[model samples]
Every structure is written in C-alpha cells, then in structure tokens.
Target: MRLMRKSRRARFWMSVVVAFVILSFLLSIVSYVWAAVDEVFVLSIDGAIDPAVASYIERGFKEAESVGARAVLLEINTPGGAVDSALRIRNRMDESPLQTIVLVKHSALSAGSLIALAGDVLVMRPGSTIGAAEPRWVIPGSEPRPVDAKTLSAWKAEMEGTASAHGRDARIAAGMVDVDMEIEGVKSRGELLTLTAEQARELGMCDAVQGTRQQALKFCGLGSCSQNEVNMGAAEHMARVMTNPLVAGLFLMVGIALLVIEFFTLGWGIPGTLGLICIGLFFGGHLVAGLAGWESVVLFLLGVVLLLLEILVVPGFGIPGIAGLVALGVSVFLAVGSVEQALITLAIAGVGAVLLVILALRFIEKRNYWPRFILMDRQSSQEGYTSRETGYDRYVGQQGEALTVLRPSGTALIDGERLDVVSEGDFVEPGQKVRIVKVEGLRIVVRPEK
Candidate 1:
C-alpha cells in the first residue's frame, strides 16, 4: 500500500512538470506572434515623385527592415513626376521583405498610379482618386504632352505588369495608360481612366476604402501595431526643391545673370556672392538627389577656372574661353540627365538670364550706382588735367629710367612725369636708363640708353 502511494505521488509531480512545460511553450509562441505583428512603419510620399522621393522611400525601407517591422504603410499624394523615379520606387517595393500597404490619401495620378499599384495591398481614403498613368513630357510652364506610340505601348505593358503582379486587373491598369483601351462600362476610347475611391473598390483595384489612416491600418490587420512615421530630412527636402526642372533652371539663370552683372559693373561683391550661393544650391541639391556626381561638379569648377584664366590672365578669349563654355554646357547637360530636360532647362536659363541681366543693368543705371562700382570721375583739360600725349613730343629726346619691365611696352619716368612708353624691338628691364626715340600721337617709343 505504501509503494502504491509513492507511485501516485511521482505521477502527480510528472504531470505538473509536463503542464508547466506546455504552458511555457504556449506563452513563448504568443509572445513571438505578438512581437511579429506589433510594429508598422509609415512613410509619407507627397508632392511630385522625383529622385528625392525615391531616395526617401529606399531609406525608409532600410530603416523598417532594421527595426524588424512586419509591414510598411505609404501615405501617397502626388500629381506624378519622373517615370524613372517612379520605377525606382516600385522596384524597391518589390525587393523589400516587408509587406507594402499604399494609402492614396489624395490624387495619385500618372506615375503615382504606377507606384500605387505596385503595393501588396492598396487602400484609398474616402474621396481620394487614382489613375491617369499616361506617360508624358512634363515641361514646366507647358502643358504635358503624350509620349510616342512606342513609348506608350511599353509604358502600358509596365503598368499592366505591375498591377497584375498583385492580382489586380491588367485591363484596368492598361486603361489608365492607354487612351485607346476601353473597359466595358468603365472607360471609353480616347479617355484615360481615372477612378474615385469607390470606383477603385468596385473595379477591384483597391482592397478597402477607409475614412482615416487608422481605419485603413485596421483594415490591413495592423490596427494594434505601434506606428513609426518617417518624415523627409532636410537634405531630401532640398533635393526635391532643387531637382525640379523649372526651379533648377531658375537657379542657373539667377546665378549666371547675377555673375554677369557683377562682372560688367563691380569687381566682386553682393551679386557675385549671391550668384555663387545660387550655383552652389543647384549643384548641392543635384548631388544629394544623385542626379549630379562629383565628376560633373569637378567639370564645372574646371570650366570656371578656365573662364577666369581667359578673363584675368589670358589676353583674349581663345581656346580656354571656348573650352570653358563647352565644359559648362556639358556639365549642365550631364547634371540634368535627360536631353530634352537639359535643353529645356538650358533654354530657359539662357533666356531668363538675358532678361535678368538687362533688368539689373537698367536698375543700376537708373540708380546712378555706377560711381560706386566703377571709376566714373573723368579728368579733362577743362579741369587743368593734361593728357599724357600733350607733352609726349617734348620727351622725344629725353632720357628716362624704366619703371616697369618692358616686353615691348612699359612705363618710363621721363623728366619725372611717369610717361607710358614702348621699347624699340627689345625687352627692357626695370631701373634701366632709356631714351625716348619718337612720339606717334600718344605712343612714346624708347630704347635702352648707352
């Protein structure tokens, strides 16, 4: 009977041990699942989708991965921008391990549509719209124009593929890019398809329609997740502003215009400094955006050096000047990256620079500011100021000492008047005694004296 009691006690202890082990395992599983679904990273992509936007998205993904986030929610609001930039953002989304939930808070037109469709789950806020994914040449101050038929066909395929990758309808995606494409009861020929949030849901393009961002997250099963909002840094903001074709063109225009004004009027001052700042902003922003590299900057600096050599050191504009101009053009062209974009920017800068220079010159002239910048005081005979030529004939036979080294031309102290003189066919060292041989108008010819 005692043996039987011992056996029961042992079995009771074993049962307790097994229950404890099972409880620990269940707790660990719960903790792991909770940790896995707790954190969500949010990124806001607003304004035009430029290189800066692409860079920000890429960095955001890296940060999310490092923090072990399970999903990323992108709040998108844009009128579209560079196709290359949009593609870069799309490719990044595809490569990331985390799930992408795109929330179109506002209009995601054109290239924005391409990116919106690349997400694993798409949600549109109430009243938000998407589509108009047509490829166009977006020139500032000009209407967007459609691309060539070949480009249209290629872009159409890309749009369709991106949408189809996530199980969205290829026809709807194609309809956004191809105006000729028709979706029965959705879009007619000759019209690009743009859909409201309700329309997007009904057409199966959007997974859910939510009134608020939190609701959208809840719809995606991330409602209880801790939010980490990633905002654009200063460098990215600067890049976005500087990379705009119109703004970049303006900076170039202002830089060149101000420098030209400063060159013609003052030696160097406010205008020149401001001009340098403008140019620096242009290069700095482009450098940050990855549009311009160190090579382009070095080329630009070399161009400036050559130009300065031509102006200050070289006697006239020749190879250095021409080469400098070419280098400047090439660097700008390379920085802009696109031929059409470069041409447009260059043309705008050229025309705007001319206008700015004209206006600045007029303002300077009207304000009588030339006296401050230039030697405006004139010495005339009426002021008892005699021309150097007036007494040059008197010094024809006078002996003088060379005041400056003469490579055919120099200054001489003839009778202590410091006359301008030219050597007779030979170089003359300073402090050498010389005699004036002839006077032709203002020209005083001199030779080394015995």
Candidate 2:
C-alpha cells in the first residue's frame, strides 16, 4: 500500500509539471497573437498633395500591409497639389490590397478631389467642400491660369476615368474638369462643380457624413481597432517646400547672390560658405522631392569647381567660368520645373535679390550687420605689412637681359643683379635684351630692347 501511494504522488506531481509547461507555452503565444490584433491605419494627407505626399502615402500602405491592417484611412485637408502626385496616389490606392477610406476634413479642391475619389469609401465632414478639379498651369512669375484645350481635354478624360472606375457618375467628374460640361443639376456651362458634404452624399459621390474621425472609422466597420497615424519626417517637409516654384527660385537666388558677394570680396568668408550651403540645400531638397537627381547635382558641382579654379588660380573668366554658369543655370532651372515656371521663379529671385542687396548697401550696411563683418583695417607698413622694395625706382631706364622668359612677367638681369620685372603687353624670351621703363612701389616694368 505504501509503494502504491508513493507512485500516485509521483504521477500527480508529473501531471502538474506538464500542466505548468503547457500553460507557459500558451501564455507566450497569447502575447504574439495579441500583438497581431486588427489595425486601422490613418495617414494625414495635409497641405499640398505633391510627390512627397504620394511617396509618404505609398510607404504608409506598405507598412499597413506588413502588419495586416484592417483598412487604410486617409485624413485629407488640402487645396490640391501636383497633378502627377495625385495621379500616383490614385494608382496606389487602386492597387492596394487593403481597402482605403478617405475622410475629407476640410476642402478637397482640384487634385484633392481626385484623390478623395480613389478611396473605397469617402466620408466628408459637415459643411466641407469638394470638387473644382480643373487643371491650372502656373508660370512662376505670373498668375496661374487654365491649361490649353488639348491639355484640358486630357485632364477631363483622366478625371472621368477615375470617377467611372469607382462606379461614380462620370458626368459629375467631367463637370469638375471642363466648365462647359453642364451637369443638369450639379453644374452649369462656364462653371465648375463644387459640392458640399450634403450635396456630395446626395449625388452619390460621398459615402456618408461624419462629424469626427473616430465616427467615420466606426462607420467603415473598423471600430475598436488600433489607429496607426503616419506622420511626415523633417526631411520630407523640406523636400515638399523645395518643390514649390517660388521657393525653389528663392533658394537659387540666395545661393547665387551670396556666391557673387563672396567672389567680389577677399578670402573665402561667410558669404561663400553660406552660398555653398544654400546651393546644396537647393539641390538636396529637389532631389528628395524627386524633381531632380544625382546627375544634376554632380553636373552643378563640377561646374562650380571649374569656376572656382578659374577665379582662384587661372586669373580670368574663361571656358571653365562660362561652362560653370551654364551648368548652374541648367541645374537650377531643372529644379524649378518647366520653362515658364523656371523663368518666373528666376525673375522673382533675381529681382528680389538685386533689390535687397541695393537696399543693404545704401542703408543697412552701416547699421549693425555689415559693419561688424567688414574688415576695415588696412595692410600697410604701419600695420607690419611690407613689400620687397630695394629702391626699384633706380632701375628705371636701365638695360637688362631676360633671365626668365617673360610671359608678360618674369625675372630679368639688370646691372649685374637679378630682379623681378614685368613686360608691358609683350612676351620676351630668355637672353633677350630689355630696358626698365616704369617703377612704382616694388613693381618694375620692362620692355624688350628695340
């Protein structure tokens, strides 16, 4: 009986140990399963929906899928952005495996309206507006105006295509692009169709109306899911700013202005350094924004190096300087967009820089900034700076033999002494007879003996 009882006790302890092991395994797996909970990712489509915005949204969708998100929500507030960027966003939305839900928090004008339509379900906030999706072309220095008929027709078709793909009324989207489309109830001739939240829902354009973001998500059957908000990094923001035509022009102007100032002044000072930095930012920002690339930057840098060599070592503005200027102009114009845009941006920046520099020189220089930075002290004999002056005036009218071939300036043997001399607009070979004609300070001018 004692042996049986001991055997029973051992079995019971073994069973308890096995149970504990199973429970621990289950507990570990529970955390993993919990971590795989449903997610509703929200990305803020704020400001101008440019290339940067499209890139950010594309990345957000990728991340959402990696974690098996339930749905992707876009919170939009924009007065439109780039047409290409909007189209890219629309393509991405159409291809995404997870459904997209767009919540229009404010205005969805122009490109914004097209992006909002790309979603599986579009919810609008109360009293918010949507539509007015005409394609407007902006020349940098002038006002923005409508695109030409050929371009306008193509844009109208694109809008209609996008709307039709999502089962919305094609005519309604057409009215947004072409003012003369004349939708019977929503729009008339010579007028673009812009709809309020209520009107959008009535026209079958908007899925529903919700006051808050949370309510909108709940309506989409994604209530209680964890919300993942995708935010923009600092670099992205800078890139977006650089994509602006005016901003890009400003960057180029500042860079060029500072560089000019540096060249005119002595030594490589603050202006030169700052100019380089601004130029770098100009290129870097455009590259990040996908407007320019490494090739443009490389070309620009090569041009600058050549120009610097010409200025600091070669003594004149020759091939390198001209090439550098061309390269710089090409690179800058590339960053600012099309020809009209580039011209406008350049004009604005150039005019503004000239005005600002003039104002600074005329009035602002003596105040605080320029006065502190300017080096007023002269380098003279009293200040411990001196030149070699071995009574060079006495050498005038003296005959000499060229010791070194004078490519305008070389050494010559004068009165049994070697002296540094310069020819007056002539090249003299070695062993040639020469006579000193002028002397001022330490400079002694010579001419080949006639």
Candidate 3:
C-alpha cells in the first residue's frame, strides 16, 4: 500500500509538470503573435501626373512590395497631367503584385481618370469629381486643337477597353474621351462626361466612398493596421522644379545671363561657376526624369563646348557661335521633347536676359563694378568725349547729385560747381545721387550711385 501511494504521488507530480510546460509554450506563442503588428502602406500622389509623379508612384510600389504590406493605398488628388506620364504610372500599378486601391480625394480629370481605372479597386470622397479624359494637341503661339479622328478613335477604344477589363461601363469611359459620345440620359453631345462621387457609384465605376484614408482602411477590413506614408525625396522635388514650365524658363534665363556675364567679366569666377551649375541642372534634372535621354545631353554638351571654343579659342561671335546656338536650341527642344515647351523656354530666356542686362546696366554699373571686371572701356567723341580728360580725370570716381533730370543729358552739382553731365540711358531724377563713370572735357557720363 505504501508503494502504491508513492507511485500515485509521482504520477500526479509528472502531470503537473507537463501541464506547466504546455501553458508556458502557449503563452510564448500568443506573445509572438501579438508582437507582430500589421502594417499598411499609403502612397500619396497629388498634383500633375508628370514624369516626377510617375517615378514617385513606381518607387512607392516597390517599397510597399518590399515591406510585405497588408495593402497598398493610392492617395490620389490631381486635375491631370501628361498623357505619357500617366500611362507609365498606370502600367506600373497594373504590374504591381500588391493590391492597389485608388482613393481619389478631389478631381481626377483627364489623365487622372485613366490612372484611377488602373487600380484593383476605385474609391472617392463624397462630392469628389472624376472623368474628362479628352486628349488635345497643343501648338506653340496658338490655341490647342483636337487630334485627328484616327487618334481620337484609338484613344476612345483604349479608354473603353480599360474600363471593360475592370467590369465597369465601357460606354461611360469612352464618353469621357469623346465629346460626341452621349450617354443617353447622363450626357449630351458636345460635352465630355465628368461624374460626381455618387454618380460614379450609380454608374458602377467607383467601388466605395470614404472621406479619409483611415476610413478607406476600415472599409477594406484593415482598419487596425499601422500605416506607412511614402513621400517625395529631395531629388524628386528637384526634378519637379526642373520640369516645371516657369521654373525651367527661369533656369534657362539664369543660365544664359550668367554665361553672358561670365564672358563679359572674362575672369571665370563666381559667374562662370553659377552659369555652369544652372546649365548642368537643366540637363541633369531632365536626364534623371526620363525627359532628356543621353543623346540630348550629349548634344547639349557638344553645343556648349563648341560655343566655348568659339568664345575662348576663336574670340569672336562668328559662324561657330551661331552654329553653337542652333545646336543648343535643338538639344533643349529634344531634351524637353516638345516644340511648345522649347519655344516657351527660349522666349522667356531671351526676354529675361534683356531685362536683366538693362537692370544691371542701370543699377550695378554706377558702382564702377563693371570696370573692375571688364578689361576695356568705351570712348565716344560724338557724345562729346576725348581719350584723355585733361582736367576732368580727377572727377572720375567722385559722387555728386543731379541738379536736373538726366535723360542721357543733364546738369549736375559737383563740389558746389554747376556742370553739364551726360547720363548713360538711366533716367536720374533731380536730387538723386550720381557717380562719374567717365569724364571727357566737359562731358561727364554719370549714373545713379549705388
């Protein structure tokens, strides 16, 4: 009986030990499961769907795929952008292995509409607008005109086909591209169809309507998932600025002006360095954005070299200079890949350079700063000037006041002496500070003092 009692005690202790081990193992498994948090990625794409935006979306998709995300959210808000850029973005989204849900915050017109259709699921905010995917051909110095029937026909077919693939209304999609396409009760002739959020749902184009991105996650059954937002990097912002029409024009003008200044100054200092940087950015940014390929960059470099050779090696504005200008213009046109864009840049730079030169001559020339940098000075006898001012050389750097308005000819008060002076095209008000840039006998060329 004593042996039986000891055996019972041993069995009970063994059972307790086994139970404790099992409980510990279950607790560890539960802890691990709780430690692994769910993550969802939000890819925010706003503004025009240019190459920069397309590149951003591509990078966002790759990053989302790499992280094993629960869902890839496309936060879209744009009016529209380049057709080619939009198509590239659509292709990237279509090829992504991860599920992509397009959440349109505001208007998704034109290219934006097409990209929205590429997603696995389409959604929009209440009262948000979408559709209007018409394609128009733009010509420089004139209003935009419609494309040929064949091109329009092809685009309409493409739009319809994309919608059909997603089980949406093909007729409605085609109507967005062709104004002639009437949607019976929804739209009439001579109008491209744009739909509100509720209209999109009724038309079976959009999947759901949600106000914010969190609501979208909850709608998708991933409400509790942690979110990761993808954003533009420094390089992407630089690319956007480089590609912008206004900014690109400004860059071109700055480049041209700086180079001109460098040539005039002839010392290759700050102006030369700044000029090179502006030109480099114009080429480098476009090159990275896929707008300017290596060929355009090569052509641009060759053109710049030829222009430099003409200036430094030949030392004259001759045939080489003209050829260089042509080459550079052609390269810029190719780099931007459009005639209209190229003309815009050229016009802005041309006009901007003139204005800049005028301002520099007016405001900066008075400081005698140009003379410090330039090696030569001009002498005009017709304006009443001599090579050597016998007694007026002492007044060369003297500061004085304009006693009368100078419209290339004025009177000045210098050292309490009334003297007749000639201004250099800068209108100087009476009582304004004046500096003597050149003195020839009685003709003193004065400018507004810095």
Candidate 4:
C-alpha cells in the first residue's frame, strides 16, 4: 500500500507539470498576437506634396507592412503641391496592405485634398480646413490661373471617383475642383467647397473630428497600439528645399547670371565656381527628388561641352552653339518637369543674366580692368600704330612676277621681294609678269604686264 501511494503521488505531480507547460505555451501565443496587432506606424506630411513627399509616404507604408502593423496613421498639414505627386501618394495608399488612418492636422487644400480622401478613415483636427482642390495653372513668373477645360474635367472626375470609392458624397468632391459646381447650402455657385472640421464631419467627408493626434488614433481604434513616428530624413528635406519653385528659380537665375559674368570677365574665378555650385544644387536636388535622372545630367554636361567648343574652338556660332543651347534648354526642361514652369524659369534666368552681365561689364570697365578682360587698345593711324610696311609706296611702279594663280589676289615677287598683291578686277596666273599699281595700307594692287 505504501508503494501504490507513492506511485499515485508521482503521477499527480507529472500531470501538474504537463498542465503548466501547456498553459505557458498558450500564453506566449496570445501575447505574440496582441503585440503584433497593436503596432501602428505614424507618418507625417507637413509640406507641399512633391516627389520627395510621395516617396516618404511610400516608404512609410512599406515599413509598416514589414513590421506587421495593423494600421498607418498619416498626419497631413499642407497647402498643396504637384498633382502627379499627390496621385502617386494616393496610389501608394490604395496599394498598401495596412489600413491608413489619415489625420488632417491643419489644412488640406488643392492636391492635399486629393491625398486626404485616399485613407480608409479620415479625421480632421478642430478649426482645420479641407477642400479648395481646384487645379490651377501656376507658372513661376505669372499669376495663378485656372487649368484648361480638359484638366479641370479630369481632375474633377478623379476627385469624385476617390470620394465615391470611400462612400463619401461625390458631388462635394466635384465641387472642390469645379467652381461652377454648387451643393445648395454647402457652397455658393462661383466658389470652391472648403469645409471646416465640423462641416466635413457633418457632411460625412470626415469620419471624425478629433482635436489631437491621440484622439484621432482613438477614433481609428488604435489608441492602445504602440506608435512609431517616421520622420523625414536629411535627403528628403534637401530635396524638398531644392524642388521648391522659388528656390529652384533663384538658383537657376543666380547660376546663369554668375556664369555669364564669368564668361565676360577674364579666366576662371570665384564667379564661375559659385555659378557651377548653384547649378549643381539645382540638378542634384531634382535628382534626389526623382524629377531628374542621370540622363538629364549627362545631357546638361554634353550641352556645356558643346558650348565650350563654341566659345573656345569654333570660329563662329554654328551647329555646335545652336545645338548646345537646345540641349541645355531641354535638360532644364526635363529637370523642371513642366513646360510652362521651365519656360518661365529659363526666360527669367536669361533676362536676369543679361542684365547682370551688362552691370558687371560696366563696373569692370569703370575700374579700368577692361584691358585685362578684353583687347581695349586699338592700333589707330593717328597714334602712329600702322600695320602696313612704311616703305611699300616706294615700289608702286615696280615690276613683278606672280608666284601663284589668283582670281583677285596673289603673292608676287616685286623688286626681288615677295609681296602679297591684289589684281584690280582681273585674273592673274602663276609665272606671269605684273606691275605694282597702287599701295593702300596693307593692300598692294598689281596689274598684268602687257
């Protein structure tokens, strides 16, 4: 009976150990699932939606997917940017496996409005505004104007489609792009549809109106999730600065102006170096933003080479010079990514460069530095600076023989000396006798001997 009791006790302990092991295994699985589903990736778009911004959002979505995040929280506070870039961001949002909870922190106008409606759940902060997405044709030097009819139609349709896809009112979206569109009491006949946070929520455009990011997260059911804020890196920031229209135009203008001044001045100097740096920044920034590529750089370099050939090697502005100008224009156009923008930039830069060159030349001339840059000393007759032989008049009646055939000009041996002579509208052949008729400056006129 003692042995049986001991054996029973041993079996009971073994059963307890097995139950504990099973419970521990189940707990680990539950903990892992909870951790996996509670992760949220947060991204922010606080500026214009350029290529860099689009790339940032794309990377954010990729990282969220990689970490098994349940959703992404995108904070938007922007006026607008390139429509193409906004479309790219929207496409990325649509393709992301993770749900996107967009939080409009301040303003979402123009292209920003398009990207805002791409999220699964959109929440707007209090006092924030959305809409005013009417597409504008904005050239750098000109005032903003309405886009063409085709562009307006297409953009309106795109906005409406995006809204309809998310079960929002499409008419409101259309009103954002088309000023003529009216939604009764929502917007006037000739005005765009810009809604406050409260109005957006009331109109069903916003899923919720949250005052803070935390509240927005709670509205999206990710309040308990661990948030990882993904910030823009140095490269992206630089890209944004370089791709800005004002900055880009300034860089181009300064670069061209400095380079033109350098060309007018003497050898290579600080102006040329600074000019190159400015131009380099312009292209490099566009490259980082994905608006320019290796092809554009290569083309620009080729253009520079051709231009140098025109200035240094070629005697006149012919094919190389014209081709160089065209190549340079094309390279800048490609870098700028828009025809009207590029044209305005080039025009402004060209005019600015001409004016700067004139001013620089005037300053250099006043400083008596003209002799260093150009041949300012002229060989004038009054100054006793003659390019002709002084005693050439002594041989005016001298006889000579033509050394080479000439239609109007040839070399002749006159008075046992070689002289470059010109016939008075007569053809003279080699080994023919001739007479010197006149001597004018460097000219020695000769006639065939009879």
Give all TM-scores, in the order shown.
Answer: 0.75, 0.73, 0.69, 0.74
Task: Give the number of the best model, judged by TM-score.
Answer: 1
Q: Model 3, 1-450: lDDT tens per residue?
A: 999999999999999999999999999877655433377778877888877787788888888777667678888889887777888888888788777888999988988998888778898999898898898765434787887899788878877887888789999999899998777898999999999999999999999999998888788887898888889888887887787766777787888787777777756788778877987888777776778888877887788788888766653266788888888888889877677788888788779977876776666577778767876655667877647546877788888999877765768998777778888888888899998899766678888986
Predictions in order: lDDT: 0.89, 0.82, 0.82, 0.87
Worst 10 residues of 1 by lDDT: 309-318
Q: Residue by residue across 157-258, what tens digits does model 2's lDDT show?
A: 888898888878888888888888776667779988999999999999989999998999889887787888889778788888877777877887787778
RMSD of each: 10.0, 6.5, 14.4, 10.0
lDDT of 1 by residue, 274-355 (tens): 9999989988888888788988888988898899887766633579999998888888988877788788878888899999
TM-score for predicted model 2 compared with the true structure:
0.73
Off by over 4 Å in 2: 1-37, 139-142, 310-318, 351-450
How many Å off is the CA of 445 in candidate 1?
Answer: 13
Q: Which segments of candidate 4 are over 4 A away from where they belong?
A: 1-37, 264-267, 369-450
Ranking by lDDT: 1, 4, 2, 3
lDDT of 1: 0.89
> Per-residue lDDT for 297 in model 1?
81
Better of 1 and 2 by TM-score: 1
**Number of clashing residue pairs, candidate 1:** 0
Span of 10 residues, lowest total lDDT, candidate 3: 31-40
TM-score of 3: 0.69
Clashing residue pairs for model 4: none
| Top candidate by lDDT | 1
